[model samples]
Target: MATFEATAEAAAKNLESGRTLRELSDLFTPMAIRVAITLRIAQKIDAGRLTAEALAADTATDADVLERVLLHLVTIGVLTRNDRGEFGLTRIGEDMLVENGKAANPPWLDLNTVAGRAELAFTRLLDVARTGEVAYSAQYGTSFWDDLTRDPSSGTDFDVVMAGGMERRIREIAEAYDWGALGSVVDVGGGNGTLLTGLLHAHPRLRGTVLDRHAEPALRTFEDVGLGERATATTGSFLDPLPPGAGGYILSRIQSDWNDADVRTILSHCLEAARPHGKVIVVDEFATEEGVRCDSEDDLRMLVYYGGKERTMEQVRALAADVGLSVESLRKAADWTVMELAPAEN
Candidate 1:
């Protein structure tokens, strides 16, 4: 009787914790929404497919199951069902539609895309926890980059998603530094040339090179943006030797995807490329103090996706020290933490 009373009190406390019981236990809604997005239900409804049968036909889904899912969407205010059994989108549902060639949500949420397929590895989080292995490889036979490379379109899609999402941050990084003074810079592992293009656009006198495994995307972006004359793309890897004697080497948001040893190697290459007083500018979002809810969640996502974990500022400093580099300046440019490194004085 006493144990029963204790369990009852614990349950009561849980109810009083302000998170709705449904919110805590309900996984169906999110999965259903993702299905709706993958099936383009919102797009179809906007295009006048108002009945479950029609939507099922359009999406090649089971009519009965799709009808039930539609009803749940209505109950959850994502859709509305009328007396005639026709369905329509509510304001919430309308937001799911693409507008002006931009998705209402990030492209990573669409199950049809590479990022979407990658995030499905989150379902294997338990396996990851037990074995300390990456959830991505367990879900798919290959690592994230390998999967992307196997599908050429997947690589381009992933790059577009990343470049599109970081548009604002790219602009901030461009404005935060004086690229003109550097005269020439190399963006190490710079995918799609998005960051380098922004810098060149912001500083007319600046010339830049992009060193990446694939050169076509970066070269195409440079041409599309009319900066081809000033910018060049070289096919290479940051893990190997980088183009030498650049005024500065920019490593933006790349370190978080690697382990400490690999990160040290990458930084060492950049330092070598930036020798004789050139700077190695590191821009990344470092982890903050633990117990911050958002950072914890993001760290988990990184771990599951790439076997990478966000580093704290002190951890970053220690890695830099290992590579014979010292932090010359650290500041925030918009939402990014920008750290400039120079070789330690002998």
Candidate 2:
């Protein structure tokens, strides 16, 4: 009876504490992390300046305020405060150091940069939620894609973020599928040829082509990977006809940026290019039905930034059918779903 009473008391305390409100208030944590990253706090700490005063002196911030922030970070497991008033990076905080490469210096999290500005537009989520319109354009006075195109530096940053972050995922994709039988493949909208380079590097017998709006970089990547002879990079839109007769065509994480009509159009182009027995491989996140959200914030990000969506498997199959392709198989590689399609029978 005493144990039951204790359990009941704990449950009541949990309910009284308002977990929902706590979670909602935690949104400020990302901004705090952004600020810390911007000030190179982790790097400063790693460089032997362990006290808040030293960190503030190096970062040109107020010592008292910085100490508060550091204290908050310590509570969040990002830093540890010792009895000597020295602070050190926790495992999570270590990733914020610039020396850690992609993991340490994620371009999107650098609040001073364009990607960070884009992320900040999420504060207008209420406006997007009410209007079913993009918050990015409303916040920034221009569409996300337009802003990227207009600002070369920002665009380059965005590209680096996408390419650098997906290295492990690219390796998983390269190894997940059976590329042995495919003689030739075209990577539609292949950004910087990262995926194609991985694929070609893994399968020596296969030749590949990357169709992207930016061809020079893709070509350079092909050369870097030593697949220059076996791979070709062409500048083109995937909405138009692809290079015909490839054994396999790939649309890796491209469909999530467009609406249903655009997705169908891209798939139709792939269908036109794919030989009768050729395969069309789409790599994207699949929404689960059990109300267990995966990448839910990403879906919101897509909606607010590009008016696109992360779709469910059923929706994807329907879209494939509309484009005259039939779902042949599905494979899971990390958090992404690789949906294989073939020409639909009349």
Best by TM-score: 1
User: What lDDT would each prediction earn against the true structure?
Assistant: 0.82, 0.80
Q: Which digits, one per residue and each the tens of the lDDT, describe model 1 over residues 51-84?
A: 9999999999999999998898998899999998
Clashing pairs in 2: none
Error of 2 at 169 (Å): 5.8
User: Estimated TM-score per prediction?
Assistant: 0.86, 0.75
Instruction: Give the Å error, residue 94, model 2.
Output: 3.7
Task: State the local distance difference test value for candidate 2.
Answer: 0.80
Candidate 1, superposed: residue stretches over 4 Å from native: 1-22, 99-101, 165-168, 289-294
At residue 246, what lDDT does model 1 achieve? 84
Off by over 4 Å in 2: 1-20, 48-92, 98-101, 149-182, 239-245, 275-278, 289-292, 331-336
Index of the highest-lDDT prediction: 1
